[model samples]
Target chain A: MRKMEFAEAIESALKHAMTNDPDIFLMGEDVHTLRINLLAQFGKERVISTSISESAFLGAGVTAAMAGLRPIIEIMLIDFIGVAIDALLNHASKILTFSGGKWNVPLVVRTSCGGGYGDGGQHEQSLWGWLAHIPGLHVVVPSNPSDAGQLLLSAIESDHPVIYLEHKLLADYWLDYMGTGGRENVSFDVPEKGAIGEVPEKWESLPIGKANILREGDDITLISLGVSVHRCLEAANILSEDEISVEVLDLRWVSPLDKEAIITSVSKTKRVIVVDEDYMRFGLSGEIAAILAEENISPIQFGRVCTEHTIPFNRHLEDNVLPNVNRILALARKFKS
Target chain B: MTLMREKTILELYEAMYTSRYLEKIVTQLWEKGNIYGEMHLGIGEEAIIAGVLSHLIPGDAISTDHRSTPPFVMRGVDIESLLLEFLGHPKGLCSGLGGHMHLFCKELLLTSSGIVGSSGPSAVGFALATKYQKTKNIAVAFFGEGSMNQGMLLESLNLASSLNLPVLFICKDNNWAITTRSNEVTGGVLLDRVRGFGIEAREVDGSDCMAVWQAVETAIPRLRKRNPAPYFIQASCTHNEGHFLGDPLLRFHRSPKKELGAVTGPLTKSVLHYKGGRLDKRISSVSNVLALIAKARAQLSFSNDPIRRLEKTQTHLKDQFAQIKLKVEKKINSISERVLNLVQEEASL
Candidate 1:
């Protein structure tokens, strides 16, 4: 039993994979610790860092994936992923099917998302709302340190393009899981938690394309993701006092939409509200509404409380652009009709 | 021209001849309206692909731009499948999904990308993979001289050398990257700059297959291991044809030897009289390969043909198209009556 950090957990997975498989490589920006690069410690032949050409390097990662190498590409900042959408969406997403099922792009795109402290709007956008809309991509967002490590492993081993979004807020968060070297050196064994600090004991891998039902209630279902998930849970607890009994669904994946779970929840609740950290238009909330409409399930009261479409500048504006516990609580009460 | 063992020399000549032949076929297929999308013809350059590829085994991988058929074919790609891909038929390499820019054969470990210089960093990935797997195979990359100007390629070179992965960087210095000369693109002999980054480097006469092979043989073995990075070789080949096939072949340079009165150095005179020679033998074999392609196309008439496989795919795509049907149905009233009737049928029947 030991303690570790989310960044260290990701490093552990990469280090373990690199140690085990010579074909596995680490590339991106600042993958290695300041003084030591990934290649310096793991030998220069295995680890690589590219020059800020996200599209080119991402395409290179796709090219490598198609060429039988499971390449892990680190897109340092999640905000920068917009620059590499062509490589990710057009090429990486289609490689498996494009090869007539004869090939698979076992590629992992690791990037940082969401706001933490003063990173500002350009650096702190959560792409889950956008990427979840893509068909061939598997979007994984880990709310805590432990799950960050486990989900990173799952994405690394996946035969498809897995977008691992590590929120900057959870960056320095400790992985207080069992089976780790908590000494000066980082540890490997972290009890996989779906959320930060402490989660349920039996929580292993919370299955891809399935929403994690954080709270069960018949009144209304608040669907949300990223850092806002914790706030939704808190809001659910607060709403429990009013006996509103809000069902909180942590949409682990965005793109696949977990249509079945969503339909079942929306059908029973009859009132739905989506609290997402992303913008309103064409985002996760919009997609969920579109899906509900597609499935012919029109809830009596429905609304999506999202951050502003504009960029987050300072501390206060950044806070406003992202959802909070009070916001989730306030949004949940509006469906009392 | 015959330097070493007869078999070795013949391999070099055959590889080059096949590169030239297959490249010509791909170009013709594009010109004949068989293939869709942009095709970067390797018509004016053959030695580079044939030269470096001759040393690689099945496990090794190679990366290319649009003009990568030479390495793809010489590395034992299914010519019929390639031609089918060119024809945009179901039997093609990627089942006509990838088209010209995205030619990939996992069996041969050859991948052609639509984006230029994109393959450089990817070459590093495969080489990184091969090194991690502890396999003896290396990753070969063939890019134009202009690609040297791309930061991604340079980054890959640094990454390759940093990891010491088995990666043979073959810069097909054709002197023209879509009309940009080598001088205009790169400052120095690109190989020198590559060496400055701590990667071993060499420059060879790209027109001579043997010369390019000589450089690759030296670099390949060193690359097939980890720790120190693999060496690089720049083969300077001249593009006789335009950027692509129809672009027109620019008259440049002269024949290798002086022409005599009667025989007049056969390469400078009639090429057919030298038929049945090694080069001609391989070029003629391409026709036989094309014959096999025709046989595969003939199978299209049968139910087993790949084109019929679309029926199976239609079921998988039912959902993707289901919305299209509903949208068309919803939009029918907004359009003309005949157009509405043609497009808005609820059922294909």
Candidate 2:
């Protein structure tokens, strides 16, 4: 095992997958800029940098996957996915069913979401719920460096389209450039406790539809994913000092949600609070709530902490809109009462 | 045109005839309500499809738009399964999940979508895969002139040129986007639009099979080179059925008096009303309407059927033409019968 950063883990996974599978290639706008070493190693034929044509490139990636090549496409920002949503929603997501299960698109679309450095509304969004709603898509959000590497490998190996969202704050590049803003009061250090972990040196793949119990307790349960998982852990630690034993569940895959794990955790705790960075309406938190309600596992108290239905901008306003440890703690305290 | 061997010409004619006959049968099926949904037949664009696809070798891939039957037929995709698919049978090509608009054959490397301009990106992707595999295979994209205005298609054109991918973009221009005339909405010359991307662009009479065949024959060698580049062809054809079967335009032309009677009284009242426009302006508007009707009538009378044109050019092979026609009809009839019987059995079950 070796200590690895989140971004380094992603790059290492791509390198290992491409080395093993000759049919795998990478293409997108400015992908060459991020992995110049990949361009050098794989040559220009495999590491293709395309024009600023998201619809064409993404559509091409979908078709290339159908034509017996695995393509890893990058859509610089998750918010820009609207420009090429038809390629994913209509084509990649429906190709298998449309072709009567004859053609399976084995492609990975990796994009960054979340905002802390004031990238504005257009650049900041965690729309995993929007993607998970699609029928044939697999949405995977990894919280730490270890799962980041392993889940990505699993995504590449799957015979369906996978939307892998990486939060900006947990990225290695964002961590390195945190202080570049020169705002002395704004402490932009990596806030997550387990963002960096001992990733296996040899290539490994984590299953796609499983949740991990990050922390164990019985008094109350905090369920979340992506960066919110880290915030929940932080909130759990703070609540522990108040004689509150908090259980934190990190839901790695959002689409094929680990409902069994969620039920097991919520059943054990009997009091649950869901912390989600996505919007409150029609999002992951509501889905979890619906699952619990359907199962008739009525907890003593249930609550939710999610982003408001608004685009995040202005550092203070973005912080207020996004779910932070303070809000998770407050919600946990309310559930505890 | 003379450089093409007689055997090759006969082969092209056979493919064209087969596609035309198959679409005719499909039209009858649709009329009988055996096939459901909108049927967009490649009736008039047969020359463009057969002309180009006849030269395709193994490993070649094709991406096509909604009017994809001719290309798939010419490429030798199983006719029985294709008919079964059109009939919505469980044993169909896509197991009745996808109608005629969406068909795919994994072994043939052929895909078609109802999306207007998706063929561009799909073909570029296939070409990109071929380049990575270091193969001499090429990819062809078949779209209509209406798709030229689509941003994705334009982006695909620029991308193919910039990346030097081996793709052939075939624009089957029937001068119509559904009911609207394409030239009214399109800007500038299409050949110029393609040439602006630094790719070689050509125009061919889609009614003449030999002309399209020769143009593609000259372009294929350049595409097979190590540093392959993209090519574009704008083939001017006609939609013999107007756009889709039972098109109102064709219905109006077929019985003008009956069709226009309902609108004529209201139209005259609007023209005579003083509140709307001046006398001469309204009169000129009526004259423009008359001129459009005349043009439509003229188009209907003209024969741009590629199969008939090819038959006209093959007068010396009258006996061979008769033989080919008989064989094609027999084959189509047998496949249609088998498909209908299977669908009937499935329905009864």
Candidate 3:
């Protein structure tokens, strides 16, 4: 099987969905940068370029979904999604309940998130936690090219609005900066060179709210999503040198969280460390810790490794703020189980 | 404009009268505290609703704002269901989850939102679907001049025009955003601002039903043709009452009756002198006297309420308008009783 880049896999998945469903259409600013030229390939009617009006286009997507079309609206960056917060939070999330189930908004919003380059404040934040906090929305953060492809397929098929977040740093070009440049055990390779793994030849759809157990162990369960999942995997490898068997869990679906898998892992390991790129306060890390605490899992030792309260634009400052393998390993060592 | 039939003109009049009567009933019910929460009523803007909607077909979609009673009434939405919803009955629209502001009738392809400027983008979506499905249906978005400055509405204008969708953006200019005059808040000519997007934009006197009717009727053909584009209609009407039912009127130094009469005198005269069709005998009789006493009274007293004008106009038709109002009143009463039972049942639950 040949490896595929994360962005390429996303484009392939959208193309497959568009080929299969005549009702599917795409709208956003500069989707071509994401390697999507469905306007050229599938006709301009299927792939639409919208003005930088996030609220209107997002509302248009919700309306299109209500009118019986599956629309994929893209926000260039998750940070800019705040402009459409009213549409996303108030309209898309509540239309079904407010209408008494008269409407089903099968709209998918795809956008890039997380900071690696020094893109300053507006482009660097990973607010998937805030998105997950909103009920009635399916928040999916795919860590690898394969899951990115499959999860997008599932999101398009979902009966509700799905916010699909792709990490800007996880693309093939940025793998050079991720530790040691495609070297096994040292470098975190991207989709190329079989780092994230090969996408299936035929498009496959995954379940909306399931977690993947990357490495099974009993000492500690490391839970994370998106790019942090790779960091956890790297951390698990590092902890293996110390004879600390770490179980790495990739939470693909941040919302409708895979609580069963988390409980099963937390119960088996009896110690857990949740690693998240989002801000620690009022975010996914807290949610995970609260979930474990509420479940009353006996002899449990819980900790979290998340981004600092604020992220700065400076590259060194961003490195300190964002979670890394060293941070995950340090948290794991600090957990006194 | 093609000559509208005598029956069609009377039907339009009946629709306008129905909207006015419904708002008065809403005020009565609201004052008595039967309807919970706030209600935005278009007391003197009935002509805009009756005129534009007179051309609507079943498949066409319309999105409206909080001031949406007139459109729903024109669409023949169930009075019992609407009243029950306003009273928060479990059997109401949305099963009592959404109040009157969130009323949506799927069967009628009508959805009303409480948020201002929201209907513009939603109607664009509806129009996008119609164009994609290759249907003759068009989508109409009804909002006030107050919401015309909203970013989303302007964005929707650009989106609709760029996509060449079959959407009609109707801005019912009541000249007030609550107590603020629209001109004081809105800058430049609205028609020119909309035409900046290279889309067709026009204005009409909302007091004249025939003008509104003619404008919408003319736009329909262009919207249905090949490579159809979005159309904009700015119907200038009068805000006869305060923003909400409970809004203070003393601040404006005017009573509701005076404000209503200031607008209704010219509107009633226009409807009476309308030369499109054969008038009802009573309406013709009013036109004869309308010229002599048009300016004699600036305020309508309780006995000379504009709502009673419909009764006078329809006397030749066996008091049909009066009978319809009675039917609505009975239906409202029955719905209120059902709502009371629902409230008790829910409380027990």
Clashing pairs in 2: none
Q: Give the per-residue Cα lDDT of candidate 3 at B342.
A: 69
lDDT of 1 by residue, A1-337 (tens): 3455565565555555555666777676433221022333343334454444577788899889878898888886677686578887788888778879888888888887776343334455787767767668888887765566666767777788888887765664322110010122322212233233532222234456777787888988888776677777777888889988888887767756688888888899988889887888878888888888988886457887787664432334445667777777776776683
TM-score of chain B of each: 0.68, 0.93, 0.77
| Tens-place lDDT digits, model 2, residues B224-262 | 899999999999998877666655556568777865774
Residue by residue across B1-349, what tens digits does model 3's lDDT show?
6887767767877787767766777766666655543567876677778888899887899999877788988898987667666665566665544566677899989998756688999999999999989999999999988677668889899999999999999998866554334564467999999999978999997767767888998898888888998999998766554456544332123444654455355345433542312345434433333321332222122232334443454467546655666776676667656666766686689
Stretches of candidate 1 off by over 4 Å are: A1-4, A14-20, A34-41, A173-206, B1-349
Count clashes in each candidate, considering only residues at least 3 apart in sequence or on different chains.
13, 0, 0
Q: Candidate 1 residues B158-214, lDDT tens each? A: 888777777778877755544223453256667778988898887777766656667
Poorest lDDT segment (10 consecutive residues) of candidate 2 chain B: B269-278
Candidate 3 chain B lDDT trough over 10 residues, lowest sum: B291-300
Interface Cα RMSD for candidate 1? 25.8
Candidate 2 iRMSD, 1 decimal: 26.5
Cα lDDT tens digits for candidate 3, A1-337: 6578786688778877887888898887534222223443454456565444577788889999999999999886798787689888998999999999988899999888886544444456899999989989989998888998999999999989999988876755333221122222322223232235688989889987999999999899999888888888888888889989999899999898999999999999999998898989998989988888898887788888888755543344556678887778787888743
